[model samples]
Target: MLWPREAGKFIASKARDVKINMEGVRKVAKVIADAVQEGKMDVKEFKQNEVLPINKGLTTAQLADWMFLINTLNFNFWTPDGVPKFSIEYEGKIHTGYLAMVACVNRAIDEGKKMYDPHYYSKLTLDDIKHIFRSDTPSTMPLFDERVRVMGEVGTKLIEKFDGSFINILKQVSGSAMKLVELVISEFPCFCDVAEYEGQKVAIFKRVQILAADLWMLFHGEGLANFTDIDQLTMFADYRVPQAMAYFGALEYSDSLHQRMVKEELFKSGDREEVEIRGCSIHGTELIVEETKHVMAERGMDVVGINSISVDYFLWDYRLNNAKELEKIPYHRVRCIFY
Candidate 1:
């Protein structure tokens, strides 16, 4: 089964063994209620145009190119031992991690490179890509070689199969988010995010789902990016959102697992404990969505627009807004391309 569908099935079968607190679900609902009351919980608040690099004055095609490449290399920015973050200095401003990657791509476009052309990147050299993503500081981007390989793979696939544009790929899906997810994973091996849990394979598809979500947000659910099944996407299962979930008391780790996380222990990809953390976070967010809907309906507020995607946006933004407080909770550490 694909993610979210498989995720929901897993939760149904095993959530009783996981430590999900209904009180925590209600607490998140209250937070959403306050934000809604203050007119701050709008789903538009999470749109990519607000944070995308060089977002102004871009045509729809350009935006699709930018989002495609950005999501292609978005993974594992967390570093240890006080290393400076992966950052890019563009137009006198410094951007970090994912934003920094976008800045670099935009900068490449400014330099007269046809960055959106797969033919351009498919034949790119190591030095060329390094210069494109050059950091402002001595600390380089993590997983440099892997990033190059994935970019090359994506560019080659796009050129060979999709007429060299992500827009073409979107057209193939015909505005179905679930179909897009299936196509992305099947076509791009790098976006394949599967894990084994209790001897059963579980799909996460974190990056691909977020890529779809980004498209939905960027196009405001219209035009070529419109997806009829947009609500099918779950909260992107990742390290940061799980940290927020832990802080909000929506997720609790076993004592042994908590100690491992606090100690900054490294977990191999698909490790049982790591899978549990991510899986539970996905399931817990699903519950929070339900709880929030119930709370809103009980108050005679409209629940027409509420969905897991918007709820996830609220939770992710809440973590960023309260990073100081949430930092006390350690996120499970797993370094992999899946997230």
Candidate 2:
């Protein structure tokens, strides 16, 4: 199987002949240097407390279920026309897009539904899912039917194969991150994120990899989430991270590609430009991880446990916090479940 780390190295080596800019990478490294010097970038920054639900007191099984459900349905939520995004008011605050989806799931759990249970979700109807994910505002989620279908599919698969628990699958992986990813893609069709480049098969597996990373984060690298090769997982190559990378000068697109993105042109999942953007972003984030470690070493700081997953979280959170500034750059628009 083509794992994410191996795919990053392979696609990046192949992409050097493409029109991606290395000068931009150098500029991003400088930014990383400043962030490290300012003591803003560190693996410890990606704590679960930084997320929502201040005092839910979730168990290990519930947390695993939450991660599995959310990551299975996580995908495109970009609203180019400035419409109100799919949002939910949860815990007295409004969350839009991906966070909103997570909030809704949490809301279901709060309303006395065993939503974390695959057996419960497997029997869910289309309207049940629609109501569960219903937006607070006028804007509804895009690909609503597809999302509903995927929820039922994944839930049923879990019940039939994994004994109605996502934790069972994790236990079967034997503490290997790559094995977990392979298991997810092989068993769950929605998690199969792959592309072909130059007669070579490349595996991005964005959602599956993020699920693994979230497991590691949620468990603090202990229990069922303690994967020995967690560091081997690369960054989740989605649209937002690439935009952040472009803003930080770690990724540059051709003028034609840039214009298309600015105009909100839709690229299919495996289009050449889309693949290049996602692949380059993964490789660029790998570089950022290395550069941040080097800078930490130079500053006489400890760099023992720094990895690509933490770097990805940092970049993703950076993009969210700096949305206004990063919006100045156009993000590639690809409507696919794989992201």
Candidate 3:
């Protein structure tokens, strides 16, 4: 399979329903350059988010297991229209979508479930998951069955292959993020987030790459989190980042595609429009990273920590901050586990 970086550029070259706007990319890149210059664009941002598990003071091994379990079940949090989101009330706040999932895991841990252990979750019954992740909102989590299947599959594989902990696989990688990504995809079939476009196998390993980035941030790039090739990861191309791009005029969708999105039409896993949207988002973010670096260098500003991962984070954060405004731009809906 083509790596994510290569797959991005390749897909952009042939994208029919989605197009990259270079001028918009440069604009967003300038925003990122300013963030970097002001010392705002750093991995520590993850720590500042109290909702993240990083603030829990867990040991490195426990953090790894938690991230492994969370990212394993991270796909398909987006809910259908007019339905309440799968929401959880945690610590007196209602957390929806992805945060809700994280809150559920934390809640399970608080209730004395070994939720992060492979041996424990590998044998979880559907009713167990239902109770663990039960939503305060009316809507159940999307793709509940698929989530259970992949959760058990990865948990069992960890027990069988990596001795029941993701850190074992990390120890074998010798600080190479690429190797970790490759090993995760090779060992866990659920993380094989790839697509076929025009007879070419294109890699959009969103969860795998995010797993690497999460580890890097959790350990602050030291100890077991030292990844020599973290910069090689492309953006975690999911539904929201593309919406943020389009909101910033960086991604332009064809009229038909826009109408479908406006209607909340659910696209299949490997459909052409779906591939184009995600692939173009990846390539567009890559351009944003390069341009942001260029802007920083031309001004003699330090570009020490600029990369696709940071840029993706900025855009995803922007989307969250401007959710009401971005609601004008409908995000493409997909009900697949690969995201």
Better of 1 and 2 by TM-score: 2
Instruction: Compute the lDDT of residue 248 as modeled in candidate 1.
Output: 80
* Candidate 3: residue 143 lDDT (0-100): 77
Report the Cα lDDT for residue 217, model 2. 73
Q: Over the stretch 1-339, how does candidate 3's per-residue lDDT look in tens digits?
A: 798999999999999999999998999988888877787766767422546665565767777898899889878888776787899899888888888888998988888888778899888888898999999978878777888898889998889888888889889999999999999999999999889999999999999999998788777899878987889999999999999999888999999999999999989989999999999999999999899889989999988778888888889888877778988989988898877
**Ranking, TM-score, top scorer first:** 3, 2, 1
Q: lDDT by residue for model 2 over 22-133, one digit each (tens)? A: 6666566566667766888765574333444435777778778878988888888877667877888877877777888888888887887777787887778878888888
lDDT of 1 by residue, 220-279 (tens): 799888899888888888888878777888887778888888789999988877777778
What's the lDDT for all of these models? Answer: 0.78, 0.79, 0.87
What count of clashes does model 3 give? Answer: 0
lDDT at position 155, candidate 3: 90
Model 3 lDDT-worst window of ten: 46-55
**Candidate 3 ranges beyond 4 A from true positions:** 54-57
Clashes of each: 0, 0, 0
Cα-based lDDT at residue 10, candidate 1? 82
**Candidate with the larger TM-score of 1 and 3:** 3
